[model samples]
Target: MWRCPLGLLLLLSLAGHVALGAKQGRVRRELAPGLHLRGIRDAGGRYCQEQDLCCRGRADDCALPYLGAICYCDLFCNRTVSDCCPDFWDFCLGVPPPFPPIQGCMHGGRIYPVLGTYWDNCNRCWQAGNHSAFWGMTLDEGIRYRLGTIRPSSLVMNMHEIYTVLNPGEVLPTAFEASEKWPNLIHEPLDQGNCAGSWAFSTAAVASDRVSIHSLGHMTPVLSPQNLLSCDTHQQQGCRGGRLDGAWWFLRRRGVVSDHCYPFSGRERDEAGPAPPCMMHSRAMGRGKRQATARCPNSHVNNNDIYQVTPVYRLGSNDKEIMKELMENGPVQALMEVHEDFFLYKGGIYSHTPVSLGRPERYRRHGTHSVKITGWGEETLPDGRTLKYWTAANSWGPAWGERGHFRIVRGVNECDIESFVLGVWGRVGMEDMGYH
Candidate 1:
């Protein structure tokens, strides 16, 4: 199977030259599904650029350096004629190609325009009239439909004080991920869906990981965003949108249960009104502590343990400080500015898409969103430049991003990610681990 589309994949493409080169090619090849190659003057239906890309039988033991993935090429082994480039699925996978053959707007071979618009090589499918850049949203859905975190009225934190406490001089690795360090404790990202309550989802997510870490694996609970959505009503709007401060406030004061106890019901809730009714509630047991007063909504769990966290603290937009916090503590909640193009992110280090920049105001429209920043790292682009980025977990579920996580440029506050970072400690005590 081809790991990626067969292409020259030159260093120039790293500088956004892939599209330019594809336009110059004479032939096209459907190298891999969606991994279309406008080619370096090659076609999709043609053989590999090099005879070496073709190999006989399994590629693992083939010992070919230039060939990236297994592409069958032989006539003597199975007693049948075979070419690696032809019918990729029939020879290798033993199944027909998954997609039905459709008359595609042929590129390179000629500029064949199916409609008013022509396919741009290594570019997006374009059409006349209104179009959407974001995958699931309409072109005119505006920015508010999916994004839902209000930027803190003031992201201004005491940078001087924070730097002193975090100790700016600490030597940090070039990269780090809380998931790798903590393993199962770092919860997989969750989908916030139609509801814009990223404030709730991210808050709950960070709390979930921090608590699990602080407890040393004794209490790894997936805290409930639904718990906050319905009950944390002071200056909060549940699914429609809410404040990060308010979310942290609830996790500290009112507290919440596990997602198993109170699953998210806001995905399909009416955006015009309040969230679904609060399913779990708590009563103060004593000493300013609270206990769940009802059974888990999912009766099978037989648990209604209330999870609580400490008041949140801000991580000023210092890259080192943010990295130190994530390494020492756990995931932290970060407010990100999500533009329309952000919805179309498949993979790779994300900066604002170049096509969406400048011009009309709406083309650049964006909304604030809160995401969980789990780690940070740097990428070396072909241009010999090092780009640092933060690995952030979006609330859009495992299917939507790099398995529900995306990397934004780390320093210079790309999209305001580090502008207002917040961290909280899980209020774990002996009772949480069942000692009491």
Candidate 2:
């Protein structure tokens, strides 16, 4: 009995709307003469069924009842998501919710208003808080996951003795860069991706620079970190993480082929995932030299010749001494603590800020990582404040942080970057350079 009355009312309302539209020459605006209204973002469910509630045109009165609210399914809903359904993107558009959505993180029935910043490790989700397990949508998350560095200890710490002073009274420059002096001889930075193998990356990078600088540009090979990650198995856990001591040991003894030969394959989903098997091997050629026993793992690149390095030695934490060693030798490796805010670094003089100090202790995690210190500089702020910083090459690739480099506060052992600095020499001989 009641159905007839309700049906008649709906028909009359729709007819009046059409008659008005005919008089107005068309729907004056987007509000069609329908019997419904717009809605807000939907709850996580299947609400967008275009066949039923979908509007024939730009109808604001096209929506579905969902969880005590309306879920919009019309073209007008796309213009203003104040009335959009959560599942509209999935059910209607068949796509991930666009980043920086109408809201921030919606997680575990809670709305996080920070917008793509909260990285939930347990759920492996992100951005509007509905991301995939493998990727993130925030600038802080960047392109990939970062790895943990081995903690500092005697195993990875050392100092170089002054056998004889090169120049005791010479005044050092306020700034210096190895790349500026060496130019094309110094190779650019490389990417480590998600692997916890910075121990290998920094070690191999320092050795590559020293060898190239010492050889006077004759043997400028980008030595392979993949070589150490795969083959240096003495108390080292490959992608799981390792100490620089073990990496330097492998470079001095077993040696490694060029990056063009071995190539890195440690970007698996697991930060500590198993590294690929050693595809290339080397045999001692006597006189502290070696030769590759097989072709390069990357068959396309044929330069599989083995390269070795001399012993690794640590430098004094005194800024002057470290500077001299770097200018005379090449880029040196430094072990430092990486805090959560370190990942947010883009440019300018970087000192560990206290911004994250207020966060819960669990969220204030830090890790030890290694990098190549190629140079140093000082900056004067507008307020006449002077800042000193070390220029370093990060393994996160050229797209990040001053084209793959970062400047951290120097001299006072900020992040302990100066505490565990190291230097090494490449074992390049005249004959090894393919010349007489």
Candidate 3:
């Protein structure tokens, strides 16, 4: 399986030779159903002269370790793969390459840069035409379609008023983390599975934190993303993806039940599907179907007042303002872009590093991912300049990215994270009723 049609190509590249055969023209072929190939002119595909690079699954043998995959020419080749590497899924799943490929990345003052590695089986598919499970499209396309398509929320908070009230530049603390302050109130990192509903999960998670913090731990209830996924369908798609702001709007008006009542079903499917029907608060209305009802019995009470976000407001593009909000209120929801390089991030403050031989843009599409911004900190640079970063709580489980959290370059709107931040005040179910 490690064998490839790259012997001739590698010899040519090594000898600094150009194609002289008739293998140079637009030839079409079908790799699988719905996956047609066109414009592949050469038998060796494309060539590059980079000595440090390697293909998706090729051997890399050089004195100094090489950088991650880079795109040299039309083909994403490295020194070891000879020339013309297959696509990620084809290379790994279709042919089962002979050797496993290891990639190199940089992080906080690490010299050798081999600090860690992870099992990237998330996109490994053996079935034909099923490359990465990211909505049957390239990684970038999936992200862009799910996140970049959503329109910004209509409700806007008065940034001037908020800054004036909070005093944005008021010598804020160097670091802050919501998990440390309200450890019990904050939920563990979640996994959304193959569904593109991080928007829903992140929104729900942040709302839960707000309710818990606002009520001083007396009303720490885990809100259900399932509730929003099934019930809130006004201006957004349910599981296929939705807008962060629109989700907040739904929470403000129609609130959600606890996870105990309706647990999340995000990881239940491999393909994107319509939101499942709300079953917890609904009763069977004949024909084996359930109809949604407002009231549902809780463990201690039959009362039926949906938990709500008093008001949802946007936190504009100000890092200090965002920090102040988190320090004062609680966690806030953020819609950030996920580039191809982000999936490779393991630890430390993350910044994008392009893999030139990979043609990353062609393989992965840009995606807008929603996460909860829990805190912020500043790392002093060697030149005495300060590098500010934001601590984000992800919904992809603790196994990924800094133990369910990631630190991204902040203050500069890295990944456009600071562009559309949102916050809200949650209403506890029994706080007003004097029920501790």
Candidate 4:
């Protein structure tokens, strides 16, 4: 998603007004079947009514003309401005100039983008006052109309352009090997019953693995997600929803240990208790002794709290240098917006529809929390569709999908993601490694 040299405010202005007789050379190419270039005056005369030129009830009711003078019709004109602008279907059909690709999953002629397990269905697809599924545009028409011929550079591909060579055939180390020595490695079985803190569970598990590999020579004790979830210092909302930053803080203060002592209850505050002391030491002791060393701390750290949450900018933010550095250096967490028609999980490809950040409410509801981005994946859809995608480590438990993970397409006309806030956790020894 290229930033309009002009910002979103400027884009909104273009959508609201009729472009006067500009030079013919500046007009965008014809986008779809019903769309064509006409003089600004003619467009205004045809769309503008004596009262509200923008209005759609009557041909003369100009209050809100369909597609806002760019393309007007009785049925299309009646739709809201937002319904035609920044919408996946609208862009596919080229209703608005400079059309972009569509995101989310298409079902029954409408797009339904899923955020985690939640879904929002597009109402535009339904027929006038018809509740039945037969109402709206077919999937094919919507795709053709919104995702017209105008193709923009894929944000995912553009960001990873320098790493193309490495991307091919790249394989992420097993969860344990990725973060070897850390006691919190995800290898430990999760305690879903007592530790409903998905955020803490995932983060502690990943951090433990990473820290162990980087600091220790061996993959000793695997951290328990249940321990981090039930630990009092990191308590927030339950696993169904909780703060990502808070989860990391819990693990740093109270290093995860064996679940044998502290079991999971699938809910916060259930069977919770103080961590045991760390006592394992190598005295001609082998793997069993090392595993026993993962005992919990006698008492939780007093100041186990998230000092700050660093922002992880997505490809669209144009911070390639910074993003590249983080990906190469260590694990990076990010917040993203999910779209509908962009659903396809092939050999490994994950695609999403395109959506602009012009609307705040829509953007906020997309994805509120952050998750670690382990690596990237590429695959051809079962139907022979091809695309690149991101391999994200989500906060949801293993039962959610592929062990609590999902793939997001990288560069394709339709699968694009806007990333915000690359998240980082601050702990005693890692305070200096703050993200920008």
Residue pairs clashing in model 2 are 39-83, 40-83, 40-84, 41-84, 42-85, 42-86, 149-368, 158-314, 159-314
Local distance difference test values of all predictions, in order: 0.64, 0.66, 0.56, 0.34
| Runs with alpha carbons beyond 4 Å of true place in candidate 4 | 1-196, 232-235, 238-240, 258-261, 268-330, 337-348, 353-369, 379-386, 395-400, 411-436
Tell me how far the alpha carbon of residue 212 in candidate 4 is from the true structure, in angstroms, after superposition. Answer: 2.7
Candidate 3: regions farther than 4 A off: 1-161, 164-169, 267-274, 280-305, 355-361, 429-436
TM-score of 2: 0.68
Candidate order by decreasing lDDT: 2, 1, 3, 4
Count clashing pairs, candidate 4. 63
Cand. 4 Cα-lDDT = 0.34
TM-score of each: 0.68, 0.68, 0.63, 0.37
Model 1, 310-415: lDDT tens digits are 8788776788888888899999888888865566555667766444343355545678898999998987755567878889899877766687888878788888
Better candidate by TM-score, 3 or 4: 3
lDDT of 3 by residue, 339-374 (tens): 654653556677654332343335434567888999
Model 4: ten consecutive residues of lowest lDDT: 124-133
What is the alpha-carbon lDDT of model 3 when measured against the actual structure?
A: 0.56
Error of 4 at 257 (Å): 2.5
Candidate 4 lDDT over 350-390, as tens digits, reads 44333334334433222233445555545554456644555
